[model samples]
Target chain A: MVPDDDTQTADERWLCAVLQRQGLEVEPARLAELARAQALLARYTEFLRQASPVSVRHLGQPHDA
Target chain B: MMPEADGDTPGLAQAARALRAGSLSSLELTRHCLARIAELDPGLNAFVTLTEERALAAARQADEELRAGHRRGPLHGIPLGLKDVIDLAGVPTSGQSSQLHGHVPMRNAAAVDRLEQAGAVLMGKLTTHEFAFGPPRWGPPGPPARNPWHAAHFAGGSSSGAAVAVASGMLLGALGSDSAGSVRSPAALCGVAGFKPTRARIDLRGSLPLAPSLDCLGPLARSVEDCALLYRALAQPGEDFWRADELPWGEIRGLKIGVVRSFLDERSGTSAPTRTAIGDAIATFEALGCEVRDVSLPAPWEWNAAGMVILLGEAFAYHEHWLRSRPQHYGAGLRDALLLGATLSAADYCRAQEHRQALSSNLDALLEDVDLLLCPIQASAAPPLDQLTTWGFLEKPSYGIAFNLSDNPALSVCCGFGPQGLPLALQLVGRRNDEITPLRAGHAYEQACEWHRRRPPL
Candidate 1:
């Protein structure tokens, strides 16, 4: 659950907006947990972005479409 | 009809031999499994559905065929289970989710068709994490499969029931789908042998997909030979498919084995027992005439990051519609996981794919030098169920996911027991499209060690 004060993270605030934009209404009880999951993915994606440009051969794979 | 085989549950190969010898009938074997399931499943929760009548009928037909000199193959008369995500015609393939509770597929999965063609009796649908994404938890239709090693501990996810059933002697062999370590993880924790063949080696049709690029179907069994037998039946023929005679078996001497020591580093959170078990495994390989050396790959967390991004993104793409239409239908753990995918962009997913190619290339290059890469499958023994969290992987790098990212054939075999008496496993990875090396190495390792001989206290 989201804390009442002082502990709300930027990830929590950003995720709230992202969910709202996607029309996903997360229960207040789960907002903090979802925010944590979002943050983890964000960290992972950020790590991947800094790695390298995607090769053309990879983009041609079946699921890449 | 022959009397039921007394003593412990026979491995798939042993059962096949007994059946062909006329000392054990398929009906007797099926009844043995049925009786065990009836007596044990209430506590293990390994099976979500039981097709006792169908199994009996199939077993009888197998017996008639054997008696008529129509032996199909090694799988003939063997009883096996399918992870709930794999379809068995006319049976509900729940994928262990509330949404798919009544969802029964009209046709058998390709693997199921092959198993049936090989004369294997289908015991029933085994439990799986919800849609193969949720953590091990009790929700929706039923509780998660309890680890046979320690009832209070988890049986590992996604393929939870497959490993539990195999470990508990409820099934001789079972098929479990893996995308990012599902099969190996469960098999490790449950102390069974599991083989994840190269990507798409087995036809994915009729099995639910967790990630199209990463998805693989594999076998879990009491021994590597049993796993190999099941693999031979399920895997589609390809340019690189292994012929029955091609398996190294006792010919694994002089093989080059690479130990990924970096995976055992403190950063990976590898427990001391797991590390010592892996060290002993290395020593055993050396004693068996394998040329072992230390090797390193890109950080495990790096591969894990790439794998997880692709997994979460692809899974979200598949579940988005249902998630939007009826979020309540999902377990909170899986629902939360799928929602994390929404945070990723197409760029993120594609970039991970690109990173995947680089990681695969690195592994391929390393395999050119080493015949097999040995590592720890799990960082530690199975944790108590109450200690598990949905996003626990975020905190610890999964040792098995790197192989999934690289599309390698990886085998998980029980190596030793931890201090808690729970099983610890070591992983052996082979080159892409080459499952024989890992299976051969695993089989040889089993012959050299007595770990696989120990059964769960259950």
Candidate 2:
């Protein structure tokens, strides 16, 4: 599933702004970094959405052993 | 003076003295420590892997170097433990996750290399929470590391084993990372001195990430001076930030201390004993010539919410691949807790980042007039091991994370004992990259107060 376009764009802009403020000479390179970070975040968000309803106890323990 | 028979009274100063005077060889010290671990660790579960063979070999090398007049300074020949997340070459740098159980690194983390170069013997890999994000839960591939003060109580995570090992004398000191109170919380509960140096003071290379922006590697020891010794070694040599030599201790006569009473004094469900102990510590600080004034925090919830959003976003980025490929390998609490990060929209994360910038600005302004800020490390002492809930993180006012957001140095110094007789501590926060001032103040206070002289009856 694709992340909401508006939210991703906003995140990218915010990250670029932060980098610029930190005086890191942000430009297109900073935008690329933001894009990569956001993509990773988006992927994980989706993974959470698809995860089964597993209890905290059942996550690590053997069930049918 | 003779060394204090009570382990608590003999701080790191005594240990260093013993090493320097040839009263204790590093090899003998290592054997004594291994024996302690074999005896007490069965009850405490402080180590995930005890490197007995490596420890002995390193100890032998340390002894040879000392005899050859090749001293490495105060931490020379000292034995220390690395939290499982800090990679030591050839050891499994498990994030305590089953998914990464067999994961080993080809090189030591920067901090570990620094410690080794300082002549510190690596005792073993200590336990941590799954990815350094969750509490210790029972029924694991291993037992939960328990508090040394009370075997049944929790050793706060995700630096759980590191704190326990240091407090129990199984190791002289240990390395721990702090993202959101992971270092100080456990150090506070376990009656040890834990330092969270200013962000980036020590290199994070080869260390596992909880939040890349916030994680800091520091030492957990029995005294502030020991923490300072380890900090000086781990920090990049010649870096201006690790300037402990310039700090003048016992000169706190004109220091301005911000009490930070709003969040600290707020009725955040802290136990009465903890409240009383903190009250006494403030009075003690006042008596020691510090100018104490109440300071306001940037609305407690705002700081926490901002930290939570950023932390989750960052942590999820690291765990995403594994969460997809092997969802069942993570522990229950950690999986659910990390899942919350998954639900954070990009907008939410950005808003959190914006809030973080504002909070950092506000906190810096608040500290402009004060040399240091003081608060309770945790709201209370160690809770029972079995009583901690899945959502325990949401329930407390995290005094440690506020500094993490500001990228400042924060230390946990054991102040006194709570009602249950477990250790109670106060958080000392300094300006960005200014660890010297806090270390000096903490060292001076430790000298004046008898608190650091007391040890848990293990």
Candidate 3:
């Protein structure tokens, strides 16, 4: 394929391409927007990975997780 | 016969008295509302559908019922609008999405059924953002609703039109749904009272859902009492229903109000106008003999982040089919958000729920010390609608969402005006299912000030 000119990372681009293969249509401009969202999710993932101070209170709380 | 223009719309309570005293006919009030909609809705665009015939018929039935002494209650013959997310029989419950534009329901949602039986006249459907995630213009099915207070500014969302209609007197009250501040945000911005009862206490059947875990239906009206009336009428059994009119407004004397100061502290994203307004409100609470104290909880952003994950996980499950099949039909803003929702794994979703549990328990513990928690409704007054970006909804932490995550009750009432004359308001949050105390505090505050009396200069 032609060299992609937008700023989406390869993984995000692959994710969009996979979604497109799954029949979800997205505009070219939306690829950049999707990348921004992925960046946010990255932050969220990092945030969630770290144990919160009150996380010990979560022991035996019967959470579905 | 009364003149077409009565200048200002009366509150639901005052109108009920006029109807009972034989001074006003339901048909007259209905016609007055229709006239107002016709004259003013081009600028406000609060209504997506005008059920003129249905409204008039309902009004006539109400008049007949009153004449026959079969009165319902305070909401009798009151003209109201439903946010388009609510399913009204035979009307297309668009949820402001193009995909749902042609999808009309054969039956009313349970909330709609109860409100109709209470003698509420259905004026029509108001606009929402695309599928209840909006500030009105995300390639949705209808026009963006304008703020009645300022024509060029935002009216908030997704209950943007619900708040506008009430503020502009196009309708006295409207039902607004909240997942993350949909009801209260617009209400605060539009200078009206927005109420979010505990989500679990009310029936959610037949209404569209953005996040089933956090979705709630509520009422926005001119005053706290009006909100309480709708709240009692809509609540299921054991939901702690009380008459706002009979609230002990005198209870303001000794109640300990917890002021969430961190939210208003430096760099908290609260604008100067909103800061001044909250400062004034705290002082007013002190003057009213309420003991105000600084209270802290985990940073609100943590709760906000947890809520977003839950909402996306749930909303994605509902919209996955559409996201795969008819993605083009959604607005770019909602489309991107939903697609991003695709990135959250089952692990992410489950962990988010775990986080939600923690946040809920934390909020519950935080409230054990205060009768009610005072918080800012918006970082600032309603900005111009043009400033909203496609991904704007996801960018910020909503103060209202924290309560939703905790399943607590919240009410947004106008605290005061900013220098630009736009409305600034606060959120009064109470313990889970403790709807009475917050309504009481809201009523007490609403009475001690003239904020609720001031309407948008439509």
Candidate 4:
């Protein structure tokens, strides 16, 4: 879970900036929500970073349509 | 001999036998199903649309064809429902979403086409989770289907109604699309048979896309034999169809079975009743002369996360346009869930894809010496509706998604009942395209035990 502190707020703002750059609308009604989701998804990427160590990467997989 | 349809509801295979023997006409079977739906659907909430007129017309045509010595195979004259996501030419495939309320397809989905070709009587569209992504958020279109075993409990989603309809005898068979445990979860919760064949075994054109890459259309019925019959009817043109009767049932003794014990370890907080049921099943298999061996599997969390990323990314890609144009049209649950995918980077999806391939290969390596892998589909019985949390699906680790990622054929068959009398199911997985092994094992186990014979108290 993302911590509740000053850093978290700053992180949310930074995440919001990246999302806006990614072409998202980031409307006021959904701004805070989308920012939190961005943080969570970033964590998913982080999971991949950790998983990469234990997981095999690209074992000659034939691309599935 | 004419089957005396006293009060008991015969399964699909038996009903088809009666229809072929001239003891039961399609019209009679259709009427019985319609009556049951009328009497029970008010409490069960199993359908989005009921095609009474068309079903009767189709049944009449089926009877005419059968009387003229024309048989379309096992599903002929059998009344069945399709998960609302399945397209049926002129019928609206609402998918329990208010957004698609007016959407109707011009052609039947490939799976639907196959069922029709086999002379199936299309009863109607059954309820599904909104967009096949979230649990029921009821309103506008219809109410979510409830478990017939205990009305207060949830019949699983996103294929909720398909399981409920079959459990309640409203339909002999159903077509449910499983992207991540949707079909199997519902079948286990409702105490019926659900088969998720190899990913490419059935085509999905015209079906509403949830996660295109992972989507599989499968059958949910009462017996493994019945599920196999439905699969035979819907099997892809050249895909290997596993016919249950053709396999040597006793060969199960020679095959090796692997049990994934870590999947239900205490750290996962699996329920006792479910664990006990699977334990009994493992012992039963051993007693029946099969060699059981313990197998180590990847952490459930890893497999669960792997499935979710692929699911979320693909789902967002499919619904991105609508989500942007008419966000309010989506139910609250799906709207938020789709938003998470909006932030997924291209690298993230690619990474998940890499993991997907890796995981499949790892599981394949483990199963190289084993004939089948057996595990529990659900860790507990169906909980009450109020007991479900909004984000529960995201938080929990799934037992069914690993095979989905591997593209292996997995089946959910009833193993036993919990103390509350709700059903628990055993998941049988087989090598890709080698679905016959699991079906034969399921048939043998089902024949030996009385689990599949039991039905919901409703």
Candidate 5:
């Protein structure tokens, strides 16, 4: 569960890429971890796209009163 | 009246007693709690919204009623915090998500309505994880709630702020929802008492859903007695199958207790101090004349997997539209979790559902001869703040989750502290609808031990 050193570095790089894509000026070192985090997110989302269903339960009910 | 440590600050029981004796007015107690929240909450991040105007007005009304000789009960005029996921009229029930930040409600959730009817003043809304599924990430719509013991450690979640508010004495008692270990984890880490009642014991009519099948509402407080009191107020008239106050204590004098040794001992990363504390707790039970027997049930991971499938499927069902539309509004941790939920198919969900029934039946058979089951609440003491991650909930058996899968009641109380002075806890679970036995067991232990009497150095 604890992200390893190389994985942490990759996550940092991913965050940098996201920032660059967003057109925000940033230091690569400053957002390195955030970059890897975004990449991990992309992986999970892709997993959902292939694994999840179109609908489940209580779909029409309002969650909040 | 007892002189206040800071000023007029009393534990929940003492506050109830003072209110009954007319020695303390509701307005005075409400003002004191408000002042405490103002002074401490900035450092703790326990509260998301402070209802000063409504709370003060309610307290004044309670005082007038008391002066006119009409009184409610223990909770009358008492100030309490509601976790943000629970609804309150005219307040935003954000579920700790940016997607629903401005969404307000027209009426209170059923649990809140019951508490308010019992005369408990609503002080504010407490923080929760993003939609009650992920770990804390600092750069949110607001800061993640910090542990009162040490600001550098986590307070556990997704009931993060409920535990902090009660632990710091900002609120005597607060409501928290547990889907996996949300309530118990935070309570254990923050050094307090948390009760996850039987799933059907309290209605989930108006609260935000994490996993409908596993979600439960309960209380986190300074003592088992306070949790019991809150349980009494929230328990439905004919629904709750167990009553702690009505249970005969002497009946448990020679009851047999099942010790799931492998579950507690097999895990890595468990600290020596936690092991010693758990060992001491078992010895205490043996010394109290109870029969302790070793028992084995289903593999812990089986239950973990079953819980994940059901939880993810249910949560994704709730958030699919939002995920499809405003995905970027969610924090990275939550966004990934919902994506995981999104991946579960109907067959996966149904298989998990069928597995849940089998699991519950298996657990029931295991509990046939044992009066209670005992285990450790967490793998280790609270981790440092920066080390918290999205996979934290998936890394262990979550001594509390299997019971949730089985819809059984579980209670967590401080057993002892680790070498670093962080709290360690023991979990006691009772049969379905039989919450009283565990509560009584906890109360007996609390009376004999010093753990509940100690507070964090903060």
Candidate 6:
């Protein structure tokens, strides 16, 4: 379910700003869809940050291994 | 003479024998495939291009070469379809998107070049999700490929058409790109065999990029032996390539198999039939004289989280330009998926990468004790096509993600049927660059079962 504008979370707000700054348009009808994506991204990214915080060197490798 | 239209289509192995025995001609086989496509593709939407004249010309050439006793290899004169995401010279590699409606490459993808060099007949291009990013959307290029087992169900993507074509007898085998389970999911759902080789084992030149970090080209076919044949032909030249022939066929005894049942849970919505199917497959492996034991991996949600972050980040890198300039051309599902990538921070992507490296290490440690890892490719049988949503994968952990994250060779083969009669699949994962073990294991299982012999009612 899409949160109304007044109920937008910080990530949703950030996502809106990112798209606007990049000059990318999200159709009004798709706001609910985009909000759902934002919620998923937030859930997963938080899990990554908290799960086994491995120190990674950002070497320019194409893939994980 | 052509095989009966409604009868079982000969697999590549059978076709090769018939061709060599002078009992079946390449033209006859190609014509039969073309006829099958003409009859069934209307409902399946499996092909984006037919290439009838070109396929016929190539079949005749293969016949002439064979008559002169100059066989190229096992694939010579066999019919194969390419997922449209992989380029075929002068033919539009649409990737099922309007943005590339008129774009045609002048060179075949490196794998395509290799297949042709082996004298394989090019049947045409198969369907894929738009840019291979998300669920198929209703759009200009064509309807999504429907499951051969039941048209109302999902075929699984983004390699939907490749699996559907092979399962329905429209093509004996086909090439597909796997990034985040694209090839295996469809193959599992369509009740065929799909193999995703270790990353970088096959040259990626000339194929459209999804997440280059995760993208690998693989084959979908009716049986494990057919997948092995195609993999041998597509893999880059190396010691690994030659070692493929050394696979001890029917000798999987004494092999150690690790079962990862934690990959599914109530949250993943695994069906009872799927669980039973996998349980039965484990028993079959044990009866074949293999040692089976339960093992654990990092939680599926943890691996799933890291995979999605990296996949979205890398995919957005490839698609940012198109997503920005021609946003109108993309289907809403693809657009939404690509946009999600924009919302990710560099920190998030880096963390995901860290998780990937750590997970790879964990998997490597696990593999040191086992010959192969086993799991279910899907939690259940193919769901109704209408039930699929672009964001649904995020909620359910995927069985195919950990292999992609670790770059291991993973093969999905049919194990049994579900209560709904759709196919239930089991995945066999081998150590990186060691696809031979999984292929051998899958081949043994296929030989012991009747699942692959059953045809879809379509």
* lDDT per residue (tens digit) for residues B39-131 in model 5: 888998998888999999999998888888777777888889988999999988877778777989999999999899888889989988888
RMSD of 3: 2.9
- C-alpha-based local distance difference test score of model 3: 0.82
The Cα error of candidate 1 at residue B109, in Å, is: 0.7
The DockQ-based CAPRI class assigned to model 5 is incorrect
Q: List candidate 3 segments past 4 Å from native.
A: A1-8, A17-23, A52-65, B1-6, B138-140, B243-249
TM-score versus the correct structure, for each prediction: 0.94, 0.85, 0.94, 0.92, 0.85, 0.95
Off by over 4 Å in 1: A1-9, A53-65, B1-6, B238-248
Candidate 6 lDDT, tens digit per residue, B358-453? 999999998999999998888889999888867876888788888999999999999998877899899999999898899989999999996998
Q: For each candidate, what is the lDDT?
A: 0.87, 0.77, 0.82, 0.84, 0.77, 0.88
Instruction: Report the Cα lDDT for candidate 5.
Output: 0.77
Chain A TM-scores, per candidate, are 0.62, 0.35, 0.45, 0.50, 0.36, 0.55
lDDT of 1 by residue, B1-458 (tens): 33334546888887888888898999888888888898889999999999899999999999999999999888898899999999999999888888886798999998899999999999999989989988875766878999999999989977999999999898999999999889999999999999999887899999998888889999999889889989998988776566642444767889999988778877777999999999999999999999999898987889889999989889989988887889989888888888888888888888888889988888899999999999988999999999997788776788888988888999999999998899999999998888888998999999999788898886
- DockQ comparisons of all candidates to the true complex: 0.58, 0.02, 0.37, 0.29, 0.05, 0.59
Clashes in model 4: which pairs?
none
Model 3 lDDT tens row, B218-328: 999999888888887787757355452354345678888888876776556788889888998898889889989998876667766777778887888899998877777
Rank the candidate models, highest lDDT first.
Answer: 6, 1, 4, 3, 5, 2
Give lDDT tens digits, candidate 6, residues A11-48.
66667778887777777678767888779878999877
Write model 2 residue lDDT over B1-458, tens digit each, in one string: 33334433234556667877887788777777887888888898888888889989998998888888888877787889999899999988877878786788999998898989888899899988878896575645576898888888888988999999988888888999899989999999998899998877889998899998889988899888888888888897544544433334457877788987765665655667777887888887888898988887854555566676689879978887766567678876676566556556776666566667777888899889899998877888888987886565554457778778889899999988977889988889998877888888888788778686566687
lDDT for position B208 in model 5: 92
